[model samples]
Target chain A: MSDSDSPSAITWCAIIAATCLLLFLFQQILWLVVPFLLALALYYLLAPLNKKLVLSGLSPDFSAALLSGAFLLLSGAALLFIYPIAIAHASEWQIALLRYLEGGTRAIEGMIAMMQDKFVFLRDSDISNDARQNLMNFAEQFSDKHLGKVILTIAAWLPSILLAPIITYFLLKDGAQLRRFIGCTVPNAFFEKTLYLIYALDRTARLYFLGLIKVAAIDAAFLTIGLWLLGVPSALILGIISALLGWIPYIGPLMGLTLSIMVTATDFPGDMVLLYWVMGLFGVLRILDDFVFLPYIVGKSMHLHPLLTLLMFFVGEAIAGVAGLMLVIPILAMVMVLGETLEIILLDTRLRARHTYARNLHKRAVTRDLNIS
Target chain B: MLLNLTGKFQAFKGTETPQLTTMRGITLFSQVATNELRAIKGLLHRRTYIKDEIIFDEGEKGQAIYFIIDGKVLICKQGRPQDGAIAELGAGQCFGEMALIDNSPRMAQVRAAEDCTLDVLFREDFLGLIETHSRIASKLSLELARMMGERLRQTINSYVL
Candidate 1:
């Protein structure tokens, strides 16, 4: 272990505290960091296409603008269609939640009584009847106070939301220029090696994010159709919700599974076949995710050990819950890559100016000796 | 096998870029301040070149200024009537800029030392821009004067040394 002396420890503590305090104070900036980072990520992803487009007679500005416009229109159209449905479903889910909870509680109590021992799922976390009622009342009161403002806030940010494509357009346009600008900034000695590291990290980030998207899409397809077949109402809705939530690693899938089971119970009530099928199908998809999906898709590039992944997930959850869980692994990958780059840059003086100069001098001296001989 | 890694090859691994490193900043807009550069960079034209490819040869008539966005470029003059290369261009420095003001033979040969990309603005269009915005003429003229002064100073220093 790298133990620190008292003075160093104090310094370290101060550093960490300052960092955390800065992060806490600049939470909005942190959100902006995601979008900016995402824009860079988008820049990388669309670089090849933009290059091709430029080569094919479209100007970079035109290419970036055109592509950004198309993307914005598509996603905007999607959100425009999807938002109202999602909001409606969400409201319906919330209102019916009491009846659902009450029904779910009674059903669970019944199942526990019926099984008497076997089913481990519904045997725990029994909210008391009076407590459950109070909770429902509280939920209603909270919704009454908060829901309108929440909807309005999301709706009000429409203009800003529309600005994303414009931001994306500039990123794609300047992306190549920015990258080259960074390269020109590198010293001669370490430029190639540094470029290599950047290239590797860029490749890894692109692959992992793209793989996640692919897997999520597949997961959505399988879950939605499967749910529909099982006669589970709002299968598309649930599937999409599950797909979105499932980005949260281990916790997300389990949460999705529990909710699906609960919803199934509300309608079907006692249908074990459909329940097993849903569980079993999801179980297989997950197994496929671990065994088949990830190996080929993201592979070991996101090679945090399970122990590390779990730790990161929880730590992220602790900090910012689901959003953190989704983002932390990618962030961890970035940090690791950055750390690696820093180590190479800082520790390896052979790659720096003085060393490079010395090497050149030595080579020249050796060449002179050879000529003299 | 890794011989000839020099001669202005791509940057090495484990390198950090200097803050003031001059990229091949293509400046067709002299009237456009640093402020405007930030805003209108979105509208610039971008181009790319492979390693060792000629961007524009020395004394070749070309009409565009080039920005060194990534990779490496060698701005070499056929030293004193085709003797040898005199200088290498790195990132963040602008070149072919004089063309935006005047359509003349290139002063030096520009080549990509590595796979490079550049944002280019053509002289014809840029001059048209200058024509409409006459304020640009004054500003650009001042800039051209400053650049010429720097060049003259460098030349004097070289001859004196």
Candidate 2:
């Protein structure tokens, strides 16, 4: 058996403590970690382009610079053209939201009035009074607390956004040297396995990020065309929002659909037929996403069980909110791959023999010391 | 067949001038073109091992084929010095070629018989090359099959005698 297969209570305690310590350190440096992870994702997406360029006779530095230049140009174009239209649509949506809320309040009041007229007992009931008060309190708290905090967080993250492109460029430029440096650190016994694991992780992350970009683009295009056909205002903006939110897996697409429905309902208030059509469109798209796009594009890289996935989703949500929910699956998948690779290395007879030999040598030394004393 | 084997051994023995030239002399890579060899050079990892240093232990997972650049290597079933040694390969010879076909445990322990310089070709890189350059992969694969077949025929003849 491998030395790691059996551990005393003290060993278990030490392991747990070390894990907790690492987690605490991770939490403290999360600001750095978040941007680094984003940069790594970007690196994975852009590295293949750089490699292709280099393979075609361009120098590595030049290839990386060219890709970075292209990205900057694209971002500049989006800021110049798309940003203004999105901003204008956002303002329009804000106004529409207030109008919808006002209409909703009036409808609720009318329902309460009719209920009071029909049932004299409910007019004097504390339950009805409490429900109304609770709804008002919840809405006030959401606006005052959640919305402000979200805005503040985004403002804080603005500086970190600049780090991503710079990190991605360096990763593209010196990726081979960096990989070799890491490989050098691995023990000779586990070198091949470690290299295999690193390659597998790189492949998985690259495939996932590229697949996500493709899926997002397809989703955005499909939604924009469908919304335009349904005569929805600001279809482009709504489509972009849907595409961005679609990163969050099960919860994100639903949130995107609800937001689209709300905006559609506000623009064409009391049009029940139009609302039904929008809902139908989202349902059809959801089916397509689940059955076709996810299976075909994303492939079966994540071999996680559905129950474990849901549990992790809830745990992730509890720990880091929406970001956690989006990152959890990929992180878990990587961990699974790392664990399996390590298990193979650990189970190898030579590695186990080495461990056994070391343990025996230590034991013999300890016994000799005791006898000498 | 004996004369042909002797002639090939003599060729290897005579051409120990440079590692790259000797690599071409090896039967497994004899058919590979110069441009293909240049491409394959990028995947080769060169390492120097001192005398008596263990290259790899028996029953350990093997993922690379090693080409002898200089000096000699001992292939033994057990780790102890000269215990059950099957071969003492010199410069221009290669070992662990079976690893290129499958990621199974090493059948024999490999140790440096003298100070040795070797080029290692890992299976992952080999697989990657197969995906990108099918022509090179096919040529190498064909040569490897022929080498294996020759060895199998020799082993069967020895057993019959």
Best by TM-score: 2
lDDT of 2 by residue, A245-266 (tens): 9988778888888777667766
Across A1-373, the per-residue lDDT of candidate 1 in tens digits comes to 0112112334434433443343344344554655554555555556557655543445557679878888888978999899888877996856776455555554554455555456666346453454556645655565676666877877776655566666778878776466556556765345434544555566678778777777888888889998999898889878878876777788889877766776787788777667778889789889988899888887877555678677766766666555566666776666555555555667665445443553565466458657653
Against the native chain B, each candidate's TM-score is 0.65, 0.84
If you score just chain A, what TM-score does every candidate get? 0.74, 0.74
lDDT of 1 by residue, B13-89 (tens): 22223311222143334444432343234324556565655566676555666667778777776433235555565
Q: Which ten-residue region of model 1 chain A has the weakest summed lDDT?
A: A1-10
Quick one: best DockQ, which candidate? 2
Classified by CAPRI criteria, candidate 1 counts as incorrect
Error of 1 at A260 (Å): 2.7
lDDT (CA) per prediction? 0.62, 0.70
